[model samples]
Target: MKPAIHPAYRPVVFRDKAGDFAFLTRSTMTSDRTTEWEDGRTYPVIDVEISCASHPFYTGTARVLDAAGRVERFEQRYGRDGGRR
Candidate 1:
């Protein structure tokens, strides 16, 4: 690998706003915002709307869509016999 050609990987904090969760990790991404971490050191902070902590799939709180009801309504409106002679 060549020097000065790759982005620097440094410690940063990712915060999930909805879940109020945060973690420290190394990433190439840059941010203007900073926050003091648990280690008493300042690091770049990135705010996210959703993360594994708040995701419906991971939390097992997904909502099921009513597909059967929609299909039944469509069939009723279009006619059951297809209007064929």
Candidate 2:
């Protein structure tokens, strides 16, 4: 641990607006924005596009790719024997 050479590690808030979720945690990242947490304290807030709360895997809303449909479409485009003769 060096003196004053390392970035400050402090409590910050990560917010997922789409999911309406936020959590307090320590981070070295900084933000000009601030928000009042549930504990009645203000902390730097970082807005994220996706988090566990809104992620497909975590929420179990992942889309299953239609591989069979894709194969059918490809065959239709190129013929059954891959457009050879």
Q: Would you estimate the TM-scores of all the predictions?
A: 0.73, 0.74
Q: lDDT of each structure?
A: 0.93, 0.96
Relative to the unseen true structure, what is the C-alpha lDDT of residue 84 in candidate 1, on a scale of 0 to 100?
Answer: 59
Per-candidate alpha-carbon RMSD to the true structure: 3.6, 3.3
The residue pairs that clash in candidate 2, if any, are: none
What digit string (tens of lDDT, one per residue) describes model 1 on residues 1-53? 99999999999899999997999999998999999998899999999899999
The most accurate candidate by TM-score is 2
For 12-75, candidate 2 gives per-residue lDDT tens digits of 9999977989999999999999999999999999999999999998999999999999999999
Residue 68 CA displacement from its true place in model 2, Å: 8.5
> Residue 6 error for model 2, in Å?
0.5
